[model samples]
Target chain A: MRVSYYPGCSLEGTAKSYDISVRHVCRSLDIQLEEVPTWACCGSSPALKMNRLLSTALSAHNLALAERQNLSDVVAPCPFCFRRLKSAQEEMARDPALRQKVEQTIESQVNGNLTIHNLLGFLTERVGMKAIGEKIRKPLTGLKLIPYYGCYVVKPPSVTCFDDPANPTSLDEILRAAGGEVLDWDFKSECCGAGLSLSKPEKVCELTGRLVRDAAWRGADAIVVVCQLCQANLDLRQREIGLTDKKEYQLPVIYFTELLGLAFGCASEQLGLDRHFVDPLAVLKRKGLA
Target chain B: MFRLTGALSEQEFLHHVVQRSGQNLLECLQCGKCTGGCPIASEKVSGPRRLIAEILSGMRNEALKNPTWWYCVSCGTCMTRCPVDINMYQVATALCELAQEGGIAPSERDIHLFEELFLKSVEKYGRVKELRTVAAYNVITKNPLKDMDKAVTLMRKGAFSPLEILSGWAKDRKVSRIFALARRTSEGGHE
Candidate 1:
C-alpha cells in the first residue's frame, strides 16, 4: 500500500486541488503515499519536443530519486509526468548507450526497474476494485458521469502500458464501482489541446469546447477526469466555450479522486471540491449526494 | 549536415527519419487512418498522412517547412489507429528536431517559443514556475494580456500563488548538470 508519489509541477501550481484530493483520498483509502524528495519537472511536452535526451534525463532524475527511496513502485498523478517517467524507463531499459548518457547527465545510477503507474492505474490495478468498493460509504446514486482520460494516461500503447489506448475502461470501472452512472463517450481518451493553452488559446478553446459540449449533450451531471490539464481545460474554459458555441455548457469537471473521496464519505472541503472553476458542488447537491 | 533547400533520396530520408524516431516507416501502408483520427488535422494542417507521404517522396524541405508537426497535439490517436503502429507523435518530434537543426522557420513560431521558454523554466528552477513562465512568454510574445483572466481566476481560486513569481531557485542543483550534458550530447548529434 506504500508508494512513492510524484505530483509534478502542475499539481504544485495550477492543480493544487488535484494534489490535495489525491492525498486526502489516499488517506481515506488506506493507501500510504510517500512523496519523492525534491522531485523536479518531468520535462513534459517541452522537453520532449526540444530534446529527447534531456527529457529522458529529467524523468530519470526523478526515477533515480524514487529508486533512492527504495520503493519499487512510484505513482505519478500527472499523466504527463507518468508518461515521461514510464517512457524514460522504457528507453533506458531498451538502450544501454542512452541509459549511460542519462545516468551521466543525472549523475545518478538508474536501475530502470521501477514500476511507474499513473494515479488511475495505481487505484484500479494496484488497489483492486473490490477493496475500493468496500470503502464507499456514500454511493454516488443518480449522478451521471463520463470518464475523460485525455491523452497521456493510456495512449501511445508502447509507452503507457496500462489500460486500453483507444477505449480505456479503468476510469469507467472505478466510477461504476463508486455507484455513479458511467456514461459511454467517444472522447474518453481525446486530446484537450494540452500545452497549447499558452501557444494557441483559441485552438484549446475549440478542442475543450467539444468535450464540454459533448458531456452536456450526453446528459451527464459532471465530467470525471484524472488529468489536471483536461480538468483545467474542461472546467476553466466552460465560460469561453459557452460564449463561442452560444450554448450554456455548464458542466462541472470533477477529478476521479475527488468523486471517490465523496463516495468514501469525505466532505467536499476535505477533498478540495470547492476549488473547481465550474463548481461541481451544485451537481453533487442536486443528486442529493452531498 | 541536413540541407534546407536540397532534398535527400527517398531511401536516405526514410533511413534518417526512421533512425531518429525509432519508427518503421517501411511498414506504414499510407492507410490514412492516422490522419482520419487526428484531432488537429485541418485544412491548414495536413495531419500525419501528408507528412508521411512527404517523407516517402524524400521532400525534406517540404516536410521540414510543413506545419503539421507544429500543430500536432501529440494525442497518440494516430498511433493507436495506425495498423503498422507508427507513432506519429515520435515522427513529429523527429521532424521538429530536424527542422530546427536545418534552420527552417517553424510554421507556428509561438509554439516553438513556448517550448523554449518552458525548457528555460525547467533549466532555471528544476521545475516550472507557471506564473513566471507564462508571464515571460506573454511578454516575449508581445501579448501581455493573454490568458490574463485565467491567471486572475487561478489566483483567486488559490491555484496560482503570487509568491511563485519570485521562486525560481532549483531545489535540486543536479538539474544544471543534466541540462549541460544534454546540450553537449545534442550538439554532438548523438541523439
Candidate 2:
C-alpha cells in the first residue's frame, strides 16, 4: 500500500519519535509512504484564528501541492494537519466563492482533491484490520492501553466525518486487531490542554496529569494516542504531576504506531522506544515483551 | 443623540464575524449550553456562549478585550455539544481575531505576542522553526532570555532536537507568495 504522507512540522521537530515508529511500523506492514512534496505549514489554530482567508489559502496551497502528486490519497499523521487540510477541503467543497479565491491565490486550479485520511483511519480502513492483524508477530497479549482520541483526531463530525464524535471506536478497534487489550475510559476524547502548553504550562500539567492519573486508576498500562500534541503534552508533563500533588504519576505516554511497532515485533531501538520522556519499556518489560 | 465612537456598526460587525466564522449569530438560541459544557469556564473567562450572545449587542469592546478568547484551546467540545450547531470554536476564534484587529486583546498579551512571532516565522521560512520561533518570540515580547533555563532542561531530557534547526526552509517558495497575497488581502489591500 502506498499513499502521500504529510508529516507536518511537529513530526519533523519535537515528535520525531512518532515519525520514526510510524516509518518502522509501515515498513513492516509493507506500506510505502511518499511524503507530500515540500509541504508548507498547515496554518493551525493560531494562524487559522487570525485570518480565515490566509489559513484556507495556506491549506489550499498544500492541497494544490498534493494534487500534483500521483497518489489519490494524502495521509497526515498529525491530527492538526489532518484537520486543517480537511477544513480546506470542506471549505473548498462548500463555497464556490472561496474556491475561486483560493485558486487565484495559488495560481493553479485545484484539479481534484485528495481524500484526507488520519493515521488511525488510514491504518484501520485502508490497510484493513484483517491485514494489520496478519502482520502482528509479537501480539500485545497482556498489555492494556487507553486508545486516546484527543480533541482534533475525531471530533466535530461534520469536519472529521469519521466515527461517532461522542464515542469513537476506530482506535480501540485497531488496538484490539493488533492484539492489545483496549481499556474503557471516559477521558478517551478529552482535550490534553496542549493548546495552552506554552502560554499556560500549569494548566497543561493539570489537565495532562489528570488524564495520566485517571488512566492509571482505571488499569491502563499506558496512554496510547495518535496526535503529536497529545503525546508531547502527556509524555513531557509526567514529572509535572508531582508539582500539583505529592504523588508522581509516571504513566508512559505511548504513540499508537509505537504500540503497533511492538506488536509487529520490531526491536525497541528501531521503533525509537528509548526516546520517550517518561520511559515506556517498563510496561513492555512487565508484559514480558521486552 | 447617539455617537458612533470606537464601535462597529451592528451590520458591519455582524458581517465581519459572519464572513470569517460563517456562524449566524442570529441563530444562536441563547440557551448557554456552550457555557455549561466548557471545561475552562471560570470567573476570568465566561465562555463562548456569552461572547457570541454579546457580539450582536454592539458593545463588542468588552467581549473583544476579555480573557476568554485567549484561554480558549479550540478543543471543539462546545461545538460538539451545541444543540444549534453554532460552531462555538469558530465564534470564539472570530472574537479573538476582532480583538487582535482592534488592538483590544487586553489579557494574555504574551500569547498574542507569541502568535505574532509564530506567524512571522512562517512568513519567513514557510514553516515554524521551533527554536527560531521561540527565540524570536522571547526577543519580540521583550523577554529575550525568559525561557533559557527551561530550554536547557528540556534539551537535557532530549525534548529539544537541534537536527531540524540546522535543516531549514522548504524547497518551494510558492508558500511565500501565498503569504504575501494573504497579508495584502487581509489588510484590505493596504500594501
Candidate 3:
C-alpha cells in the first residue's frame, strides 16, 4: 500500500492540515506515503496561462524524476498540481517529439521522467472506499457534507482521467464511506476561480462565495474538498466576499482527508480542525462524531 | 455593421489570422458539446462553444473582442466533453491575451480589486496569506456586514482563533526557489 507522494507547494504551506491529515489517515490505514526524494512545484495554473510548453516541461521534469525512481504512480493531493502533472504526462506520452523536447527541458532543469496520480484517485481506486469505511471508528452521523470537486480533479478528462467531468463520484463515495451524508450540489465541479485567485481575487471571492453559500444553503454542515487552492478560496475568501457583497454566510471548508481522520477516530486537534477559518468542531460535536 | 464586399474566403481568413492553440480550432466540430457541458453556459453571454464557433467561422474581430471570452473560468468541462478534444479553455484564454494586447479597457473594478488583493499577498509575503488576503479584500470591498455573526460564533467556539493569522509566515527559501523556477519557465509570469 505504498505510493510515491508529491506534496506540492500549497500542502507544504497553507494546506499543511491536508498534508498532515492525509499522512495520518494513510498511515492508520496501512498505506505508506513515500515522499518523492526531491519535488518541485508543478507550475500549476500560472504556467498554463503564461506558456504551455514551459509549463508542460516543468511538470514533466517532476514526472521524469518519478520515472527515474521507478515509481510510475506519483500521488499528488493538490488539484492544480495533480491536473498539471497528469496533463503533462498525458501530453508527453502521446507525442514522442513533444516528449523529447520536454525530456530535454527536464534534463536541463532536473533529471527524470514522471507519471502522476491524484491522491483522491489513488485512494479511491487503489485503496477502495470500503477499506476506508472499515477504518472509521466514529461514524460522522448527522453531519451533512458537500463534496466539492472544484476544477482540477475532473476537468480535461483526457489528461486527468480520474472521474467524470460533469458528475464525479469519487469524493462523494469516499465521504459516504466516512459515515457522512453527501449533498448533491451543482457547485461541486464548479470553478472556484483557483488560478485566478491571485490574478482576480474579487472574482474568485465572488464565485467562491456563491459556491460556499450554495452549499450552506443546501444544508451542508461543511464542504469537503481535495484541492488546496479550492479549500483556501472557499474557506478564507468566502468571508471576505460575504462582507464585500453584503451577504452573511459561514460554511466551514474541510479537506476530505481531515474528515477521514475524524471518522477514523482521530482527535480534532490532531487533524488541525481548530486551524480552519471556519470552525467545524462544534458542528461535528453536535452530530456527536467529534 | 458594414459588410466586406470582397473579403477573403473563410479558409483564407483562418489561414491568415494568427490562430491561438490552432489545434483546438481545427478540432472543434460545432457539435455543441462544450455548450452542453459548461456549468455557466446559461449565464448572460454564451459559453466557450459559441466563442469557438465565431473564431472558426472567421469572425476574427468579434471572437477576439468578446467580453464573454474573459468570462470563462477555465473549468475544463468544455475541453473534457469536446469529441475532437478541443481545448476550448486554452482557446478562450488566448482570446483574452489578444484582448489584453489590444489595450482594451481595463477589466471591471471588481476584477481590479481582486488583482490588487492578490498582488498585495504576493508582494508582502511572496505567496498567498489566506487571512491577510481576506482581510485586505474585505477592507477594499468595504463590506463587513457579512460573516460578522459567523466570525463571532467561530471566535467564541475557538475555531476562528486569531492565531491562524498571527502564525502566517513567509514561504521558505525552497518555495522561493520553486517560484524562481516557475518564473523562468513561464517567462517571469506570476499567476
Per-model CA lDDT versus the true structure? 0.86, 0.78, 0.69
TM-score of each: 0.95, 0.92, 0.76
Question: What fnat does each of the candidate structures reach?
Answer: 0.70, 0.52, 0.23
RMSD of 2: 3.5
Model 3 alpha-carbon drift over 4 Å, by segment:
A108-115, A198-202, A237-247, B1-47, B57-71, B92-191
lDDT per residue as tens, model 3, B1-191: 11233446455444333354545365556788778866555556577767766765778677765545455656787777777777765665455445545565534344445544553444344445655666666776786444556556555655445576777564544434434554364343212
Ten-residue stretch with the least lDDT total in model 2 chain A? A194-203
TM-score of 2: 0.92
Off-target runs (Cα >4 Å) in candidate 1 are B1-8, B168-171
lDDT tens readout by residue for model 1, A84-166: 99889988999998899888888889998898999999999888898999999999999999999999998888779889987
Task: Judge candidate 1 against the unseen true structure and give its global Cα lDDT, from 0 to 1.
Answer: 0.86
Question: Which lDDT value does model 2 have at A180?
Answer: 88
**DockQ values per model:** 0.67, 0.53, 0.23
Kindly list the per-residue Cα lDDT of model 3 for residues A1-290, writing each as its tens digit.
67788887567556778888999998998988888665666655444543456567667766665665565567888877788777777776676666765655555433334546788988899888778878989888888889998887888777687788778999999998888889898877877877555445666776787787778689889999988888867876765867876777778889999999988999988887877777777788888877
Ranking by TM-score: 1, 2, 3
